[model samples]
Target: MPFAVYVLGLAVFAQGTSEFMLSGLVSGIAEDLQVSIPAAGLLTSAFAVGMVVGAPLMALFSRTWPRRRALLIFLTVFVAAHVVGALTPGYEVLLATRIVGALANAGFWAVALVAAVSMVEPAARARATSVVVGGVTVACVVGVPAGALLGEHLGWRSAFWAVALVSVPALLAIVTSVPDDRPRVTAPTGASVAGTGTPTVRAELRSLTGRRVLLTLLTMALVQGATFGAFSYLEPLATRVTGLGAGWVPALLALFGVGSLVGVTVSGRVADARRSAFVLAGMVSLMVGWIALALGAVSPAAVVALVFVQGMLAFGTGSAMISQVFHLAPGAPTLGGSFAAAAFNIGAAAGPWLGGLTIDAGLGFRSPVWVSAVLMGLALIVAGVIRLVRSPQFTKATVA
Candidate 1:
């Protein structure tokens, strides 16, 4: 990967940490701001809503700017929002700050993706994108946990301050390292088959709405919803079900993050070397099994193992689906990637709500795991159907 991609990864790492750190500090924030836990929870929901609202809006508005400039602008916005988040005094102000931060987060990822892809050769695009997104995986493994620990020891506001501190270096690295050239379209020829069309933004949106692309987005949404629906409440589950102490929950989460890091790294290679659709199908299937095991297994060791596996399968497939979106909608990879990101947040928002309902209704903590398994199964079926539809005729040369 180019050095520029690593800079983008740092930006992504900072963004991801800022975005997810709130989850681990909900109790601390509630106590510090004199708000109810549920209200503190709105911090997460507000961010998700902002991403959903901002993804397409930013993509549409920044269509004409050079991708690098767009990235820098959004990263600046992100850093400013984190500053606001760090300095806010009241719950309402903090909530508003998160909203701004979420918008910047959504816009940054959308633009950074285009910038990353534009920097690499066609054959290297998937790997380059993977390296950029690996920042998110790393955040899951390290940043979130570290922020949570900081918040636990120093106060919740300290976590936001740490995020802000990281943003300065990330911004400097991006501005100094990333090239500022606009994306140029080259005509496709024998040596350059990947450079195809220079479609207008409107035409790009139209093409992206095809059935295959829609199915891919749905698959992404379902898998994300299922995973978050169960995963968000994992700490409570660990305490209530396994009788583990509160201190160990973060360690377990770190394990899950380790699995995610492994998954994202491996999945990138799989997407590059194999058919993305096939890889997506297999990963979703693996996720279903992992969720099932996590729900039904009584042993704590088994639960931890299954959670790690769930993380691995859930994130491993992410690269494949992202690559598929770019391939299916080559005319507007940024918009498509943004839409996928939005779908992910949409699922993130929905999953917790549904899981809360299940818990409120006296369903066991494991019920959400079962629910997630069913949803993942549905996603797997959708993936299989999409693959079959895309290739209805199985030639004797390859099959049977």
Candidate 2:
């Protein structure tokens, strides 16, 4: 409910734009740099790799700083990375800039969740988180497409410049909106803060790697991998399989974004009381949506409808998933948060790679949907098994 929470959301919009914009601009970048298309695609891969490593590393190094200061540092660095990305002269330099931008992007994501939750009461954390996570859905709907359009008319560097330009205002918002972190505390009210009394970075890392936690992380990875496997190739599926014109790709993406926004918003309302059930139902619904896409891609209406459902079902699980991490390691909430983030990118990187392999095998575009369905099914099964097998152990092992 605080204005600062929305400010952080604004920051995420800028970060998410940078994260996904490369997908749309890859071809133009390849041509401009005189590099192979695959090499340009590696820029996206570099960003993912940075994100996978950056969150925990940021948590480790920034543990001693005020949260507000840390956030400013992250945002400033992110803004600079985009500037470098916009101005870099060669392919190799651009690749490095992508990595740096992703590092800053990942760093901001980890801290922003902590920042949002820290501003709210325990019971309200999930709802607060939805407000922050909504930025990504909104970005998917708005930023990436706009960046793509800019790239088409003004060249790829202009898209990077556009992101950098938009980010400056968000950066300024944080300066006035977010307060400096208070001294660390473990108050009876369950107020958490940055630094010192907060669990040490090592302990936080150790606590989240337990058997139950690892299983949960795996479930997160599977769910995301499955979804991205299909969703990554959505434009092609829309144009090639559904027989839609190229212009419809943006519309399809926007519809999916709207569905995801609804999913996260609705899920936030129940996450605290029904976290497990929420995630399980989401995975099940996602599986059904993917299956529909696979079996019905030839029907344009079916493809469009199923994608909307898939977007809703897939993102519908996130608020609960994220809140569950904090529950699992209450003392090390930020690190726990990072666990979910890392799992997400790992799955994100793997999903498209797997989907690509499926396509290369001549399984065709629809095959990605099959991949999505299977992954979601596995995630559902994993959730089921964890419920059946790990309940007692999880109850006993929840980090104190």
Error of 1 at 22 (Å): 0.9
- What local lDDT does model 1 show for residue 59? 80
Candidate 2 C-alpha lDDT tens digits along 346-378:
888889899999999999999988988888878
Off by over 4 Å in 2: 182-196, 393-400
Candidate 1 local lDDT, 258-371, one digit each (tens): 887777777766666675755666556666665666555566887788788887777777666666678787767558768877877888788778888888999888777777
Q: How many residue pairs clash in each candidate?
A: 0, 0
Model 1 scores what on Cα lDDT?
A: 0.78
Superposed on all Cα atoms, model 2 deviates from the true structure by an RMSD in Å of 3.3
Please, what is the whole-model Cα lDDT of each candidate in the order they appear?
A: 0.78, 0.82
Model 1 ranges off by over 4 Å: 184-198, 392-400
What's the TM-score of every candidate structure? 0.91, 0.93
RMSD of each: 4.1, 3.3
Best by TM-score: 2
